[model samples]
Target: MRRLPLLLLPLALAACNGGTGTPVTIDVKSDDGDNGSFRMENGTVSIKGDGFQGNFRVPQIKMKADDVDLDGVKLYPKSEIAGFHITGGDKPGNGKDGGKDGSKGGGKDDGKVRIDFTSPASLAAVQNWFRDGFTKKGFTFASRGDGFAGTTSDGGTFTLDLSADGGQKVKGRMEMTGS
Candidate 1:
């Protein structure tokens, strides 16, 4: 009898997890270590820090459960919105400014990343999202595929790239000339 019940346990446990689990929204929070916070809920992410606060949302398309913490970039600070989020930069890193000659120093390069995520929005829609957002914020741009190549309000040269099929998930990146 004991052996019978033990063998049955595996079947029962597998039954409980047989199919794709229900979709759920997830909330993640991080500390700025100075009274700021970074929060990511489902497809959107946000961040806030000493002198800056930003809210971003990407398309919420179908995807298997996975984490996009972006190697713990520590940019998302504080806020809430739906749709898209892009946050990742640096406070300090292996790229330090003053180290031994061969030792790693602060990178002279401004940080950047390629953001590829599924969006219910099409390639055109995703492109429009950035274009509208940027223009409203006083960033003038020359339009491209699904994003913009232009300049920020403060005159920073800006570039955004979007890659996808007609109505597919978007693979994109946003960059400024410098920091």
Candidate 2:
């Protein structure tokens, strides 16, 4: 009887630390439609060990309209694992034309945007959110395959896609380039 308990103790311990339930991490590279001529670089997202938390970092981004350059934009997972809270500001620079006599004037800009959920269950929610948010601001979603390609109120066209590999994880890709 003593030996049986000893054997079961190790088995129970092994079950507790099976190491098979370890959280999986994914890296996503995304683009925020700003200017097609100018390439936005240093976009990366990392999910934490628990999967419920995450971080998004964009080291650099260039856009023509606001003449915006983003350095190290960070996002954190929010109420919903699929949602994120972004916090950061823009870098200094004009678009293709540097702030010059004929070039677009440049200035400082700062704000935060809430990235809503975009998973299988939240697909409709995502679409509605985008439609309401962008359309109210003067944008529309043009037809695309499992996504939408459209123009912003500011005259910037972009494509957004939501993807799921039939698993727990869902991914979204947004690409915006000058029209």
- Among the numbered candidates, top TM-score falls to 1
Angstrom error of the Cα, residue 80, model 1: value is: 16
lDDT of 1 by residue, 38-98 (tens): 4334434344444445554433333221332222211122211122332333333334553
Query: lDDT values of the candidates?
Result: 0.42, 0.36
TM-scores of all predicted structures: 0.36, 0.34
Please provide the root mean square deviation of candidate 1 (C-alpha atoms, Å): 16.6
Candidate no. 1 TM-score: 0.36
